[model samples]
Target: MFTPQGPTLRELAAQALSSVEHGYDLLAPKFDHTPFRTPDSVLDAVGGALRPMGPFESGLDLCCGTGAGMDVLAMLCDESVTGVDISAGMLAVGRERLRADGPPSGIGERGPSVAWVRGDARALPFGPAFDLVVSFGAFGHFLPRELPGLFAQVHSVLRPGGRFVFPITAPPRPSSPWYWALLGFDAVMRVRNALWRPPFVMYYRAFRLGDVQRELAWAGFAVELRALPEFGYRRDGSPRCRMVVATRGGGATPV
Candidate 1:
């Protein structure tokens, strides 16, 4: 669901028809008003979970749309924070927002200096320059096959023992309404891509936890899952949402 300031039906239609980058570019102005943006509650929970792991140095927000994840990075990292995204329009909006309000003044005068770079996640431009990396709600854009390269890139950019952290929710059961809703959405996307050029690669059901963990292991990360107790657990005693913390090993081996 979108707010009054969010994209209109026609605008949504136009965006859905375009390529992911172009669609996000068109939607950037109103992205924060839409449900698509990561919620503040999840952000707060992640910040709380990561705070104990700090105080880190340089941090990176992978696929950082409008720099929402940067807020979490700012609280944890002391030196600096960088947000890398592929959409110039999204980066422009993020830059303007940060300039207008500025980062919170909590961590002293330097205040975790923020920088935005336009780049792809599959091929990060930086070296082993970051101590921590965080991404929020951006995984659907990459297909299952692309996980290896994506995780490898993240591994490449993080320093030894650095982490790539993100929250993942357990998929709803087949009997749940949310399951049917997501299935319908994916079906429509499949039909749209079948008939259209420059296919958009967002599919809700594509990113499986088992597959993801395996890929992260293949990419030289020691994977671990910590329960986010704030979201509570399922009837089977499994966590509804868990933060996946994949730590890069100190060894200089290629994944």
Candidate 2:
């Protein structure tokens, strides 16, 4: 929910008219205050899920707006946690936030290192450097067609047997009002994109889990869906949210 401190309607409209990168730049300052930011519950849940697999040497947070996922990396990784985003303004804010969080959990992980890099997700700058890669709340920015490239970028940057982790929620059922709300939102975005320039690409229904699973497999990842017990199950007995652990080099010969 948008609060009094959040971006105003006019500001949001202006952002919607701007390029995805520029819009995020414009919104960076107020992003954490908005509902758009990943909630603490989700963050803590993901952190708990990754805790057992921890002591990872290096971790990367892809599209790490305001560095929310950075907290997870800092907790689970033993050395070097990095954040990458296309928006410089967002990266700047993320760095500042990390600093304020204090020693180990914040920007102070520098002995082992905590850094921010400005880069596009499609063509990540590093090569096979991260032991674990995580992203949160940024997938709506990528269209369905871009998932293959995005997954490939993640795969390319992970060391052999490294994992790319992200959470996926169960889609709302058609009979639910939430589903209709999302459908309406996507419809509005399509019309907005058709009429607008600089296209702010965000669609709630675009990245279906089944399609994403297949795409991840095609990108050379052996994808596994681990139920996040923290979020509980839906009426149908499926997890409300699942942590996708996609491992690279699963089929490759050891060096």
lDDT of 2 at 195: 92
- Model 1 segments more than 4 A misplaced: 253-255
Best by lDDT: 1
Local distance difference test, each candidate = 0.92, 0.88
In angstroms, how far off is 90's CA in candidate 2? 0.5
Count of clashes in candidate 1? 0
Query: Could you report the Cα RMSD, in angstroms, for every candidate shown?
Result: 1.1, 2.4
For 154-185, candidate 1 gives per-residue lDDT tens digits of 99999999999999999999989999999999
Candidate 2 C-alpha lDDT tens digits along 1-255:
988899999989888889999999999999988999998888898889888887789999999988888888888887789999999999999878766766455335254588899999998999789999999989999999888888888888899889899998999999999999999999998999999886889998998999999998888888899998888898879999999999897454221
Q: Could you tell me the lDDT of residue 97 within candidate 2?
A: 73
Question: Among all windows of ten consecutive residues in candidate 1, which has the lowest summed lDDT?
Answer: 102-111
